[model samples]
Target: MSIADPAAVREHLLAAAAAGHPLTYSELLGRLGHAFTRPKMRALCVTLAAIDEAAEAAGEPELAVLVVRQSDGLPGQGWWTGSWERHRFTGEWTGPEARRLIERLQGEAYRYWQERRGG
Candidate 1:
């Protein structure tokens, strides 16, 4: 959609998500264009990647932990659901805690999905 305003960009993303047409990595890049090229935005993307990597580091079981970007429907632009609840985050909210957030979510998901063989 090539929205120049970040707020507008958020709105479009929300609408698209509602329609089951959520943006992919490349699609979001192209649509937002330079709007997210600023230092903070770039840092946030980097942080998200690091979070994903850290979550992956927990091994195959944690790989099933799904991470998603909230599109205004949630409290933050970045979000993940644990076995118990949902967590939402934004760069302005906590720029460096992405890794910990994902790790916690991975733990929760792993625990939630683990097979109960000994019961």
Candidate 2:
């Protein structure tokens, strides 16, 4: 799903994915070229969680972790500074961790995001 990219970026993301680590809030501040508000962060989290579900459905356990592609909407950065996500740990996920997404997604807050917007 990723486009052709520099070898360095690819390397960074691969390594980060294996480790499941995200950048801290301090780190994000220095590099943020755009926005990462609370609402935005929450939305992104839901989207990321949805990605895990899709990967599980696809049977590609190895490829289920969206955190591996953790960039500012740009995959492959070796760091998890994607918006407000930097404030927390949503940048990586291992096979076992993928199952947790379902439980989290079903939680009260996320349920609202998954349902119809107006309703």
Candidate 3:
């Protein structure tokens, strides 16, 4: 059973970005009124990917960057494997380097949405 709502999820991510903060996957799941579970998370990832693709097509930053792991405050392996290259990242998707990359992209998303919000 799938419970992913792309528009609602995108709005949640946009709110996170505009607030200049990242949300853990668990948090996002809860916000969507679902409990944390691997299947739900995987489904969310598919929705997130579509959101990112639409954002990219609109020439906007990927909001998926705002959803991260609670342990490391970094996106999960799927993002690293699926998106790292599109951003021209050419290093291990871990450690300080990866953190910096995520931070920068999150900043872009924050700024873009904040500006759109007239903030």
| Model 2: residues with Cα > 4 Å off, grouped in runs | 1-15, 18-20, 23-33, 62-119
Could you estimate the TM-score for every candidate? Answer: 0.29, 0.30, 0.93
Candidates, ranked, TM-score: 3, 2, 1
Best by TM-score: 3
> Could you tell me the lDDT of residue 33 within candidate 3?
88
Off by over 4 Å in 3: 1-3
Instruction: Estimate, for each residue in 19-79, the C-alpha lDDT of model 1 and write its tens digit.
Output: 4333443345555554444453444344444443554575423322232334322212433
lDDT of each: 0.40, 0.34, 0.89
Residue pairs of candidate 3 with colliding backbone atoms: none
Please give the TM-score that candidate 1 achieves against the real structure.
Answer: 0.29
Better of 2 and 3 by lDDT: 3
Q: Residues 10-104, candidate 2: write the lDDT tens digits.
A: 23323434444333322232233325454544433444444444544754332213232233322232222332252355635434343364234
Each model's backbone clash number: 0, 0, 0
Q: Return the top candidate by lDDT.
A: 3
- Candidate 3 lDDT over 10-86, as tens digits, reads 98888898788999999999998899999999999999999999998999999988999999999998888889569
RMSD of 3: 1.7
All candidates in order of lDDT, best leading: 3, 1, 2
On the 0 to 100 scale, the lDDT of residue 88 in model 1 is 47
